[model samples]
Target: MDTLMPADDLTDELRAISAVVATLEHAQQNELPDEFAGLFRHDAIWTTGGGRRLLGRDAISAFTHQVLPGAMAASTATYEVEHVVFIRPDVVAVKVRQTPVGRDGVPLPGVNPGSPTYVMAKEDGRWLLVAAQNTEVVDG
Candidate 1:
């Protein structure tokens, strides 16, 4: 178990992590594969909601470029930071909630939200995603 930072420091770290997550959502919404990949570390690893594993920024970029254009053909997605846990002064785990919405901004029916966990690491005073895993919520 890792101890947390001070309140103020934690808040600042959370905010920084949120910014990274915001950029991710923006890139996805706009279908900008390069912009999306730019948020990750060079050796970052990502597991898609559909369980595809992407190793490194280049692999992630390739996968995004191939799938993102058609991904939002019928809907858009909004991502929100749900929680943040600092495992170390320079590392944090962020949980995000992702909802898919129609063009009218209303959530689409029968589509459960996505839960994504992003592990971020601070490098050269900037936070970059080191690893991420996205999972779809399924009702049993």
Candidate 2:
């Protein structure tokens, strides 16, 4: 097994994770990615809001292209990074909230002002999300 890397090496990974989150938030709230090269691991997996399961980058990217624009068309996404923990030097877990907007600029249906848990891993100095699942907390 690979020895755990140092904490300092985690910065780049963290930055990459942040970039992915930012890009995803951007993609979710207003637009979609024309391609899915840098944002996700080639083998990434995601669980949709409606509980549909999608595996692999191509499937996820295709799902994004088909779904996001109509479901989340408003350009108003707010994000909050709740926690970042180092499970190992190459692995980190993040909790965050990505707010979405309605067509009238109001918060959208099924999108509460809350958070979700995301798991990201550093691979060859690049952080890519391996898994992302939702939090059960309701917007208060």
Q: For all the candidates, what are their Cα RMSDs to the real structure?
A: 1.9, 4.2
lDDT of 1 by residue, 1-140 (tens): 34567777777877888999889988988888889989999999999998999999999989989998867767888899988777888988888999988866798899898999999999999999999999998961
- Judged by whole-model lDDT over C-alpha atoms, candidate 2 comes out at 0.68
lDDT of 2 by residue, 1-140 (tens): 23265556556556667786777676666566553324678898877656777787787888877776576544456566767887887778888876666556566677566466778887887678788765445644
For all candidates in order, the CA lDDT equals 0.88, 0.68
Please provide the root mean square deviation of candidate 1 (C-alpha atoms, Å): 1.9
Model 2 regions lying over 4 Å from their true place: 1-13, 35-37, 102-111
Error of 1 at 128 (Å): 0.7
Q: After best superposition, candidate 1 residue 7: deviation in angstroms?
A: 2.4
TM-score of each model, paired residue for residue: 0.92, 0.74
Badly placed stretches (over 4 Å) of model 1 are 1-4
How many residue pairs collide in each prediction? 0, 0
